[model samples]
Target: MKTISKWLALVVTVFLVLAGCSGGGDSADSGKGENGKVQISFINGFTGGDGAYMKKITDAFNASQDKYEVVELQEKDHYTKFKSGEYDLVVIHGNNLETYKQDGLIQDMSSVLEKAGIAETDFHQAGIDTVKLDDTMYAVPLDIHPLTMFYNKEFVQEAPKTYEDLVKINDELQAQSKDLYALGVPSSGLVEFYMLMIAAQNGIDLEKDGYLNFAQPEYAEALMQFHDMVWKDKVSPAGLGLDGEFQTFMKEAQEGKAYQTAVALTGPWFYGGAKEKYGDNLGVAPIPQIGSQLAAYGNSHTIALPANVKDEEKLAGIAEYLKFMYTPENLINWADGGQAPVHLPTLEKVTAEQEKYQIAYQNSQQFDDYVSAPQVYQFGEQIRYMNESVFSKVVTTEKLTTDALMKELEKATEMAKQIAATAPQQ
Candidate 1:
């Protein structure tokens, strides 16, 4: 009887351990929705006013069908969450696609896109290209946001068509003593982005084969032009940071100040604030042709799937969700949050159907000709640091010469190369 009691006790302990392990496994798996709906977790960093628009879309999608339901995880560092298998889908910056692919973190979506009947030709070529690597597509482009020009229509008759025109306008405005300048330049890292855009327009390559090459004459010329704008032309102030410039423009417009800035260089997201402040005076246009050709700095947001999402049913559900989101009927909904759809068909539809902000939509379409800066993984911060250090000094203190800036760029490039070399191989 004593031996039988001991055996019963051991059996109970083993059963309890097995049950606990099973419970842990079940908790890690995705839960089913009512009537066997496949629940998919989506993670993104859209915690601003845009979040509401995203939620609207998600709710609409949920109501449109009963097979799948999307759960949003809004937070910063979405990639980290995705790695933990808590989310099956992520919306990330297009530039990060390459790095994620190299790390084998994202799944190749060519098959998924094909299954959803979405072709590469269906999207804006520039946007589609951002998510492709060596003929393989890994993500779907959601929207294109480019650096553009916004002007006060009451002061400026029309947008400046060329670089010379910009200077002339500034000179004329300053002479009128109407308190208006030709342009309101921001003293921030974005100045470097503008310089890169000009360099690209001139056919100068700042990055070549995973290396930085700022020794080109075109780069120097672009820098010289920026320097002239600040110091020689005096059209823009010396020390107004991005926030200061934005506030100055808004305050001047609100007060009906005749001497307000005529033009401001910013992104599409600025439309809401500018419209609120300027009312009917706000005018949107592509950034003026600063170099030999028309070019602007641009980037995109993309939807990507993680490699861990291997379930066929889940993939199908995700494909359907994406298809729904990109449908022509729903694409225009993104405009509510100031996002320009990356789908070419949707863009055309918006241009024809949406008249309230037609110019803003048209300007966003110009991103097809825009140039994206180099996106070196784990090295972007270092490059930005170098750019800010050099550009801020040049714009504010006028102390860094072109030669000194070049030397500093070379050093930064060397440091970037070293970091790249030590990065883990995919």
Candidate 2:
């Protein structure tokens, strides 16, 4: 319900371009030239209605300062273009950063910050961790996207506080012929790996120090529960196509069929839909815990000045702007598109606008229970595979088990290592 100023919106508009499309104007104005504005190029993967909101944020920033200008490019082609020396700065998901860094597209941020006299200790530990490669920083953290649970108030007034509670509610709903269930986890091979993070909140690790941990009893137990949810309970929909799963899950939530879902496991964009659809009827909370701790999916949108960028002052301005973005005021203003901030201190302070975001924001705190999978490239893909493969074996395939799940995870981890090893060195 918060309205963004026009200038900030413009920046958001230009940064949301996906990697393969050409949309929007190719406007380059750095506040100098004829109009006396500074121009900087920004690229991101917003690519949807969220792009419009991002643009609003950009427009606001541009209007506020004449020292620098930002030229927005559809980010779909940014990585390719960034490697080719096309932009001044880029905002992108941290998971793909390894590939970029390995290829020498983005400069090591820790080195840049040191050269710029910025201290790493100043930023949030978790936030910094999201931007790391073997403990070396490569990007500035902008936001941390984590899984949040959104459920229908009309169908289920009391949201589950734990995973077991969700199962109980699902059973109750089924017995009552409410035909409502708990969640519609994604069906992708990577999904299982993501689920491991959920399992980790309970002390399960699928891979540790580059070794397979899926064979652990805790890991297997956690996966079996997921298998039970999909197969034995039949809480989730069957034969739902992957492409439409997100939409279908949201639709069911809106229609009061399913009670909850793990959609948008990495960002806040998912909550925007429910807010628009259900208003006060929706409830957002950190993902429920399974055993002794809580965990949720976590990923990051990283900030990095491109190697080709030469304007020192402009880069400084951006650093200042990054600082501003983390403040409660600016963060609340720009908490759309599912990208939640990683600053715990800033998050603790709240306002009415932010309270709406709290539904998703609060749950993101549990992300530490599971290392931001994106932080580990192989693990991220492994999660995607885990979620899908586990769900399929349980729901669709009906042959999923603890041992089977372990093998799948081991195989995926090996594949991830292979990808990392073969990746071009930066």
Candidate 3:
């Protein structure tokens, strides 16, 4: 009896030791906060005014929940900081979805969204499509920032809805004020986005064989059309780089200066400043069709989880936060950042209240036609920084011809091929 009792005691002691070891090990609970909520470190590049707006949403989400505490950082260069993998969630541009996914930085979000009770059909089709790569969903979209047309309502009675309408508006503006430019065309900055719009409308296939199809005839035609906006029509002044066009548009008509730029093609980033300058005279409209088909330069801001954040509790918290932010009523406030929330229901709410969100409401309608960029690794680095874009050359080159422009495109095409080659196929 004594021998049996001693064996039982030994077995019980061993079992307790095993239990203690399992209890002390690292796990999803390690990230829990003092309040017993999982702490989700979220990061993004929404600096300046955009940061402030996103913070409000984050704060509201924190206030509305108890299971998760999201601590967010806005670095403007957040991508660099995110490389440390300390963050669980990050906001990225729709076009960069493929780059992040291919690099194994972000995870496929289809299952995540499913667990969160969010459906692909719950979001706008364009927004969903923007973040999808090769049929795999990557992130939940937050907002679409399309290039909107800003005009002076004081000078123009109504916003132009088509190419002919723009020409007529420009002619009328010229007649009324000979010194003012009818339109402003940025020679830099937005050149890439502008090309996307032009490329799509001209039926230029965006990507083929993992490279840009700039070597096509339709692309040349697109360049010619863009050149004509400044040279042939003489509606826009030549060589108005990004700053020149925006500054001219925001110039005061007061102080004995005639309105220099009656119309401008810019993004939501400039709307607040323009409104402050123009007051009620600021008019927002879709960047009317420059080609036979409607295509806008735009992309969505999406929320994604980093691949390293696999804690089940933390994932649940992230899902809660995503669903909360994506809620129609919750996301409607995103318009404060001069962007359209990609949640279709939220956009409908904004469009219904146009007086409060004119630019966002109008631009929201244009997202459906936005030229979605194809997968090209570090697309901005590969294409956006190139000094010799077809648009810039067309607008600035003196006595430029199609043949000469084709040669320029050839150089850019080769450079693009080299860049695309570096992108690994997933």
Per-candidate Cα lDDT values, in order, are: 0.72, 0.58, 0.78
The runs of at least 3 residues in candidate 3 whose Cα sits more than 4 Å from the true structure, single-residue gaps closed, are 1-30, 252-259, 385-390
Across 7-106, the per-residue lDDT of candidate 1 in tens digits comes to: 9999999999989887633211655755578888888988876778788888899899888888777877766766665567889787667677767788
Tens-digit per-residue lDDT, 119-189, candidate 3: 88877788887888878888888888877789998777787777777678778867766656667777887
Which structure among the candidates has the greatest lDDT?
3
Query: TM-scores for all candidates?
Result: 0.87, 0.76, 0.88
- Against the correct fold, how does model 2 do in TM-score? 0.76
TM-score leader:
3
lDDT of 2 by residue, 84-190 (tens): 54666687676666656665676766645655455666455667777777777778776666655566676667767776777776677667554355666546523
> Model 1 has how many clashing residue pairs?
3
Error of 2 at 408 (Å): 3.3
> Residue 168 lDDT in model 1?
87
